[model samples]
Target: MSLLEIEDLRVTFATEAGPVEAVRGVSFSLSRERLGIVGESGSGKTMTGRSVLRLIRAPGRIEARRMSFDGIDLARIPEREMRALRGRRIAMVMQDPKYSLNPVMRVGRQLTEGLRLRDGMSARAARAKALEALEAVQIRDPERVLEAYPHELSGGMGQRVMIAMMLIPEPDLLIADEPTSALDVTVQAEVLRILDGLVRERGMGLMFISHDLNLVSRFCDRVLVMYRGRIVEEIEANRLSQAQHPYTRGLLNCLPTIGGPRQPLPTLTRDAAWLE
Candidate 1:
């Protein structure tokens, strides 16, 4: 059986104008493999990830014919149980480190929280586990990083710290929402490589959300292209060049070629029916 399954999932947010449908009729199954969700902003990739964890706020609604993780019905699971599942079974690495990290807390304290709660290790053991996790993410100065405040770290450092916190639990499924969107290209590559390696090595299911189609195609085994909250196309990663949907095709054409002749890229045209 798949690790996670989502069927006809829809989410609506209350607005002054009216209720806005953020996700519509999205369905997919995840195995111990990398699955990419790519879409422009407001296309519901983030919302879908949040909904699976039952993290949606009031006035926002989620509806799915069925949503399950490892044969357990997520929709039927109690919030308390869901809380236990979160960070322990299925973990999420949010988009930005600046907003995710606590300024007042030391990085080591935060990493140890994951180890303590998820692994039930002793305080001293948690501290050691935190250092090990920090080292696993290639942080050379794990001791210093543990003692330093969040504000003391660079963007890349903070992100690696976030990665360590998320992975310290050895979760079976990972949901990373543009985890490298804030870093430099080199740092971004490093973070992605670390995550990809962890997923492959541990045989964990990954729900990789991003706007960069090329990167997703290269890193993920399967691709799901979402537009205006609905999944418009699903394709094997290597065959992304042959995507059938117009939205997917447009997204590919929109990427600036590395050495190709300079030309004004075509803008993506929207179709009202595509959202229906």
Candidate 2:
């Protein structure tokens, strides 16, 4: 069965002007593979990711014909039940680890918290698992990292810690929202490599949301190009160069060629029809 399925999914916020729809009729299915949702800021990619986890708060609401994970209806489930599903069954890795990690908590404590609570593990077992997870993410010194706080780690280290925390639960699906955006370019690739390896090894479905077209195309199995609250095009990652949608083409064109002659990059031109 598909790991996740959504039909006619919509998200709207109560703005001063009126109810503004952030995601409109977004629909897709995922299995044990990486699926990339690419778009610019305010394109609804992140909102869609959060909505899948039912993370939208008051003043914002989610509506959908159907939203299911492994045949269970997510839209109809109670918040309490949804809480059980989240983190254990479905986890998310955010853009910045500093904001996600607890400021005052020791890294090991935060890392072991979920396993202890959810898996009914003893403190010693949880710590062992946490250390193992950190090792899996390629942390140089898991012992020292466990004792340190979030503020003591570098951006790249923090991000790896976040990924390790998410992986500890062995979730069936992972929603990574711009997870590598804050890291240096070289560090970004290393983080992705670690994440990619884990996802493949675990056979977990992945929802990778980011604005970097080239990165998404190379990393994910399939690509969904979202524009202004809707998916403008869906294509295989390898065939991204042949995307039919003008918006997709425009995004690809904006990427500067590595060895090509130096020239001013082209600006993207949007059509009013795309917002329809």
Clashing pairs in 1: none
lDDT of 2 at 30: 93
Clashing pairs in 2: none
Whose lDDT is greatest here? 2
Separately for all candidates shown, the number of backbone clashes (residues 3 or more apart, or on different chains) is 0, 0
Best by TM-score: 2
lDDT of 1 by residue, 1-276 (tens): 899999999999899999999998899999999999999999899999999898899799999999999988999888899999998899999988989988898887888876676567899999988898888888999999999998899999999999999888888999999988889998899998888888988899999999999989999999999999999999999999999998999889877788976889887898787876
lDDT of 1 at 71: 86
Minimum summed lDDT over a 10-residue window in model 2 is located at 258-267
**Residue 43 CA displacement from its true place in model 2, Å:** 0.4
- What's model 2's overall lDDT? 0.95
